[model samples]
Target: MVLSMGIKVGITDTTFARVDMASVAVKKLNEMTSKVQIIRYTVPGMKDLPVACKKLIEEQGCEIVLALGMPGGKDKDKVCAHEASQGLMMAQLMTNKHIIEVFVHEDEAKDGKELDWLAKRRAVEHAENIYYMLFDQKYLEKQAGMGLREGFEDVGPAKR
Candidate 1:
């Protein structure tokens, strides 16, 4: 449905969950149309993501995007875990130009409150805003320094 609307949709299944479900969905969609970009899942604390992403881009030429957020949990460690995940994702995005977007899913709000929806929406909006702010000037400079301007030219205009 999202793809039909011309959205370049991608799915992200964090380490806490299995990507098999999303994989099936992507496969079904691919059978219908070849428009979606299904980047592989990310595992928390896994050291191989950067290398994996690089290989994916080099081999498959796929643009990587990450989903950052926490799953529903009531443990004391939940907050810390969520923060850590977000931090790691931020670092990865900052250092990797191949990672062009981050979609944050607030699974903790699965109860489906209106406020929760609003908050989740706002979080994603803020993340996109920050990404664009950094992407336009700083990221371009880095790419320019590396003489890879053409490589990142397809990255669309930052959301206003």
Candidate 2:
């Protein structure tokens, strides 16, 4: 059954990313469930995501936010990513909501193709996560401590 009225999930992306992760995530969400109303806002860089997300949640009625970013493989970029992360956390605290951070660092991939793959995969996987957070908390609860990684393969729970 398709839901006509439901939660609004916000996507705050960065233009600094080499790949368009936001679009990939939006596609994934649409494919996964008809219950979500997706709202997107683009910023110039990772550091700008917090405000954009805050606006999406406070002004656009987003119940949860996905902050997608790609920090370059540089020392400064890494610092910026950390700052952005802190800001995202603060936003979550201030708004009393969840802001799922999906960051694919440039250094995490060895090449252009790998970077693209990582970005897209992370976005899609996180989209699935938000779906669970919104509609199926039990599913997530069941998978707790399962070592789930968004962009990479799941490392399932350790053997007893």
Candidate 3:
């Protein structure tokens, strides 16, 4: 559904997992701001996500897109991930909008419990990222150093 010239955010996710990352993001977004609207589309596989996202942007007029998915650590999964990433980038260029690709590979954690934690962590973190991207990008600029440096936390502007 096309929103009429407002802050409509699109969330496209694959059906690989039962987790609805869009709902997670929407919860976070609602807590902060009510100006933004959430539109969600669910596709079957990683390769199909870009097309859905393109439709969301071009047809539904979403201002920004957040794509979420989980790819396994197999060779086939890696190749498919690469192709999907390229298509997503192309979609971003075509729409001239930011598409935050939030993907958590299936092999990222050590076990089932850890995997669940990682998936939720990554999804929530990206949701926070979307909030910042839509509202306060200066916060994101500092968070760019989050994993790049050890113990890098945004403490806001420090006293001189």
Assess each prediction's global lDDT (C-alpha) against the native: 0.41, 0.94, 0.78
The full ranking of all candidates by lDDT, starting with the best, is 2, 3, 1
Say which candidate scores most in lDDT. 2
Tens-digit lDDT track of model 2 for 13-123: 989999999999999999988888999999999999999999999999999999999999999999999999999999999999899999999999999999999999999
- State which candidate, 2 or 3, has the greater lDDT: 2
Give the Å error, residue 33, model 3. Answer: 1.5
Q: Candidate 1 vs candidate 2: which has greater lDDT?
A: 2
Backbone N/Cα/C clashes per model: 0, 0, 0
Candidate 1 or 3, higher TM-score? 3
Off by over 4 Å in 2: 1-5
For model 1, name the residue pairs that clash: none
Per-candidate TM-scores read: 0.34, 0.95, 0.83
Residue 48 C-alpha lDDT in model 3: 91
Instruction: Flag clash pairs in model 2.
Output: none
Decide which is better by lDDT, 1 or 3.
3
TM-score, cand. 3 vs. native: 0.83
Q: Across residues 1-160, which tens digit of lDDT does each residue of candidate 3 receive?
A: 8755448889899888545666776777777777787889999988998998999999888888888887888989989888989999999998898888877777766777766766666666777777888889998797663453111223554445
Worst 10 residues of 1 by lDDT: 145-154
What's the lDDT for residue 141 in model 3?
A: 90
